[model samples]
Target: MDEALELGEYLPQSFANLNEQTYLDFLWSALRTNYEAERYEFASLAFHLLYMSFVSFSIWQIRLARPGQFAMAMVGFRSEEEGSLLDCESPFKFYDRLKESQIFRFLKLIGCNNEQVGEFAKFVRRRNKIAHPTGTVFFNDQAAIDEEIASMMKEVRNIEAHMQPVIRELYHRFLRDSADPEEREYTVLGDEITANFVHKNYMSAADIAFCQGFDIDALSGEPLHDAMKDLHDALVALYPAEGDVEEAA
Candidate 1:
């Protein structure tokens, strides 16, 4: 959070060895680095990644929870010959297809409070204004930037807390239903659940950072070593082994 903090606190040495820098590194650098002269860019990048992850992964959670009719279409399927079954033009296009009405319906079915859905809509509107500016002044000063970032973080944390129990219960049901001897065909559903439900969705600290334009190598330094360590611990806590879905069998 400090303007001059070093990445040594968050990354590990092996981060340097990654073949190609990824969106994860981009976000990690933005969140962990305090580029003094680039404070505005750093704050914006960190906030954007956090907001983006919340929206996309929230939808991803829905796709995981409701594998019924529409959710299946959203999650799509990949085959050796057929390729992408859903034919999404782009990520934003995909989001448009999911839309608020669809997302709210999914949330209601999953027992999410109506108030939370309203808050989510408000947040999306705010994100739209930020992502596509029309003379909107985002931050007036360093203090304001920090305050806004903190506020967004609070919202993100609240959403995560609300989702945790719901997702857990749904997953338990999926596992239980999949394991019924009379429901062996449901095993494919389990496969779809596991294949589509990325574990990274559960661990915010380890969620991969993604953006449109950024140079990966130019962003690396000794500081990233510590951030990577923190991420590793987060992922380990979420899943100690690869036996997650299969173990439910």
Candidate 2:
């Protein structure tokens, strides 16, 4: 009872409607019937005993690959010579041997500091040690659990921060270049922007011609904060989001 109270003191139990639940929400609801947020338990499990982290990581990688662009995250985010190191089109090809595949390079390419990169590498090794099962006992106390989840999210945020400009550019180009209602057989682009992200059909048909049409380099000078703000403004102008979404993490 005391532990639960202490947890509540910090967590302040949040709730979401059925359709509005985020990934973390669903996780908590499944784990605890009360749906109290026992954060980092999943991260500890993910790194220590479960393969769920890899599945989540794949989703992030796909997001970074930018579905509507010709660019794959592995190659697109790199400098010309560095990208040429591996002549690959998709990151999926190298998922099996991620450690040896220069996964650390992705952090460096996205401009993570040396300290952050080193920390990420340390967590990767920790995950590996647990994965191999060497008759060694692994302790996942609450603090350690929190650290693992924090570390994973920190690196993800680092990449996302750097990507704001390019991503916003893609969104803008998607709205600007797509055909009007007269030619298309679906919802209008502006209205469809209210959906998860632009239109579903728009995401499916990512041709080289369409990719070549928009020059992502145009956003090179934009600051990360400005890019994110611009994207938000653009979205709100096209189709306003609810006030509740702003409260989300």
Candidate 3:
């Protein structure tokens, strides 16, 4: 079996062991509290629902972004023609390259395969439908929409549970396998410190750039901190550890 597959196989079991009841209870409580606050119970429910929906989407983006980086790293080159072999040459091609990459195949070993990708894409689409003003009237008995959201959340949690170990292993491998130890150490340390800053302080992108020693106002013209706050928060939440607790205290 390929190394990626072997690495990823334990994800399903990890996912299976997760107590989803905790998440369900949290969602229910959040929705119920919102309903109690205002007489417009449906609107309140919808608002909380919307919050959950966005949270789910944010989680998916983080999950995919890291893996996508790892996958890209494994591909070992970046050419238009080379990218085309994986069906991703065009800048417009979002799904094609992800579907055909060697990393995707490796991810399959641990069961973090394309099946999960399809579901995550669907989650993003449904969130957009609800969030966008498309003139369609939304009702409280939107059972189908709610079901889709719940299913997507379940899958997101499953993917997260499974990928943690693999991610750790990949990180170690990257550090150990780098040809230039000094550059590798710097890169790894930068990644670690950036992750730490985002997790502990929920810093803005500007703050992140500053922490990394970049010029404050040069790159994107606008203040990137606010825009990146949510992303930083989500990543920190996902990878919380003993140090995070100590820092919080």
Clashes of each: 10, 0, 5
Reference-based lDDT, each prediction: 0.43, 0.40, 0.38
Give Cα distance to truth, residue 185, candidate 1, Å.
16
Q: How close is candidate 2 to the true structure, as a TM-score?
A: 0.48
lDDT of 1 by residue, 1-249 (tens): 542222221121122223312644666577655434546544565655546545555555555455463334433323521133134322223444555444444444445577866765565566556666467656546676666566656555555555555455443343334334344342343233333223322323222111111122332453443332333333344343335447765
Clashing pairs in 3: 5-109, 8-110, 9-110, 204-225, 205-225
lDDT of 2 by residue, 141-248 (tens): 555555555555555445445544444445555444333334334354445443424332112112212223344446456544344344344445543233334754
Sorted on TM-score, highest at the top, how do the candidates line up? 1, 2, 3
Flag regions of model 2 displaced more than 4 Å: 1-43, 47-101, 107-109, 113-116, 183-185, 194-249
Q: Could you give the candidate ranking by lDDT, starting with the highest?
A: 1, 2, 3
Q: Write the per-residue lDDT of candidate 3 for residues 44-140, one digit (tens) a residue.
A: 3443343333333222223333556534444554665345534432212333343322323333434565876555455445545656777764434
For model 3, where is the 10-residue window of minimal lDDT? 7-16
Error of 3 at 219 (Å): 40
Candidate 2, residue 156: the lDDT equals 45
